[model samples]
Target: MKGILSGFLVVVHLMVISQTSPTDFLFPAPPNQKELTSQKLWSTQYYIHQFQSGGKIPIVYADGKPSGLFADTCDFCMASLEGTAFVKDSSGNSTIINFAKSGDSSFVNCRACKRFAASKLNVESWGRTLWSKSQGFGDGVKNYRLVPFRTIAVDKEVIPYGTVLYIPAARGKKILLPDGEEAVHDGYFFAGDTGGAIKKNHIDIFTGIYEGNPFPEVIKSNENKTVDAFIITDQTIVDALAGLHLKKAF
Candidate 1:
């Protein structure tokens, strides 16, 4: 009887080993050769917000007042949209294969327009007003209230619109002012906005006018300062690896 019990135990051990072994049941069958020959396909769209400064430009508005330094040639207040593509592999690795910029032609001018166009310094002066408008100037107007110091563009499917986020400084780097001082800026910015330059997980911070002046100094000073941007995401990567998508939308 002892011999029979020992034999039964041997059979149970063999069964367990077979169940766990890669050669037995642990490995799935390789994909079919013909299916493997087929290319994998994935599709995704990338978008950015088109943000225009709230001030008026020199052009005439329908209301006919001087659009100010930045005013109503459709210069400062517009939104943009562009598209991009991504590919997925059998191993579930996704990569962005192509990105293209598409949208209103007006959006391009906001970023690339010259500071002094043909001798009019509209572009230069407007940058100062942009800073001032963001820092809480121009009450009594409906659209002139200060927005937020920071604007983050996110995937609505991942992080919903109108959500407020608390952005901390970037790792190991503090925000430096023109006075050469390091300051901690902890602020809450709502997700009510978007921009052509702002991609998923990317943020564009609005710094106020340095000394009530725009143009060369304010523009030059912007080159070196870094601001903390807070963005919301659900830890899912549908296109490329998470963080900000900076590729130009086609």
Candidate 2:
């Protein structure tokens, strides 16, 4: 009868409603949508006890580079600027010019794409990044892997050398690239290196330098940002960073 038909339709409607995904309440994506990979989480309130700091890749200028960059002293100038490059002429070849903090006054905030750098360019991939001196550590090693992220310099008094740490991603506005690419921090770093600037609760993160292409993105992202760090007591993880014969200074 008519009553039975109405009840059946109501049941069908309820079934469809139940099948609806709950994600719709959170992220309502359009036709084509994209997301990022999953990283661990960090709580700044719990892990942080002191003021955070930043490290940098000195902007090397042509044939006239920074001074005393050898032997014992450092005189490298460093900075963090998100550059926006534009293709000025589209003729036989594209002439692209990037405008950043140190660049010209004209093409300042112009961009080719919004959120441009957050794509698969992979921000976190800048892990093994740094800008060491000519005679810095590992300059003579055949295969030295103790310079970048693997060898984060820490205060020996606070977190001793050879101690492993698991830093989860901190909740904050996504660190955006020059072109709008976004990323958070989440990974394992070892306490292996040291420096005069690195003291007390201060931890130095080394994202090895890339001669012609220093890792500006990683340098900018981790600069002075405080996030939760978990002391990794797991022997397996610690051994991987400390090698076979090495021991944790803890």
Candidate 3:
């Protein structure tokens, strides 16, 4: 019985790792894929209160189009979908990928393809979100929020990049700020990208905003230091993110 239990544990572990690991889902039909909505997908899996700084959580695109983050098969290089092939992921040049209605999928390469983590990502930031150019990742090409949630730099030691965090808002719970303001606790985020400033117990969240683009002054400012977030480690939750990663429609 002990041996059987051990084997079962190993199997479970393997399954979890496999799900958390990166698996490519084909998104050939950009239009249909854009039609997919997180509302239906997250109806059951996500529900945790996000105790962050001022301003409501970044709103998910209502049109059902994702922030357009394709995996940088080659680190943070310039990558984009062209027809059915992933190209120019290592240069600053820009290109376009057209997904037709036939629905053919191609795999994008990743410089750092890893699995989910079980620890709090050690990153050092006041918890703000920024986009490609602002983050110094060059957004001239195909700028995308690849991981679905607001991106964040994580400590590889704590939480491995690509881990999905389901930060739920209380079932209508709002938080009062120290400066006589109200902030709602809500958002679902993921750990897709990373950064050097990310250290122990600190996470640098990517706002997906470029410097020139108009953005809230609060995000760039260090006003909100530590935001409380709930990390989801359930296998089912990981599976859900994987299913949604890189693909368009639900």
Taken over the whole model, the C-alpha lDDT of each candidate is: 0.27, 0.31, 0.30
Q: Which tens-of-lDDT digit does each residue in 1-250 have in candidate 2?
A: 1333333233323322111112211211121212222222211100001101112322222233432111101111111111111111113121111111232222111122243333443222122122232212121112223332345656678777777665543222132221223333335566765543445556555432211112232323332644545676556656655651132211
Give the Cα-based TM-score of candidate 2 against the true structure: 0.34
**Candidate ordering by TM-score (highest first):** 2, 3, 1
Candidate 1 contains a number of clashing pairs equal to: 19
Q: Any idea how many clashes model 3 has?
A: 21
lDDT of 3 by residue, 3-101 (tens): 333333333233222222112221112222233332211111110011111122221122334334333222211211111111122232222222222
Which candidate do you rate higher for lDDT, 1 or 2? 2
TM-score of 3: 0.31
- TM-score of candidate 1 on Cα atoms, chains taken together: 0.29
Stretches of candidate 2 exceeding 4 Å from the true structure: 1-145, 170-186, 210-225, 244-250
Per-residue lDDT of model 1, residues 1-250, tens digit only = 1333333233323322111111111111222323322211111112211222234343222233332323333233221112111112234332221112222222224434443344332333322222111111111112222121222334444345544443332222233332234443333334433334334444333322122211121112232343333333322321211111111210
Q: After best superposition, candidate 1 residue 169: deviation in angstroms?
A: 3.8
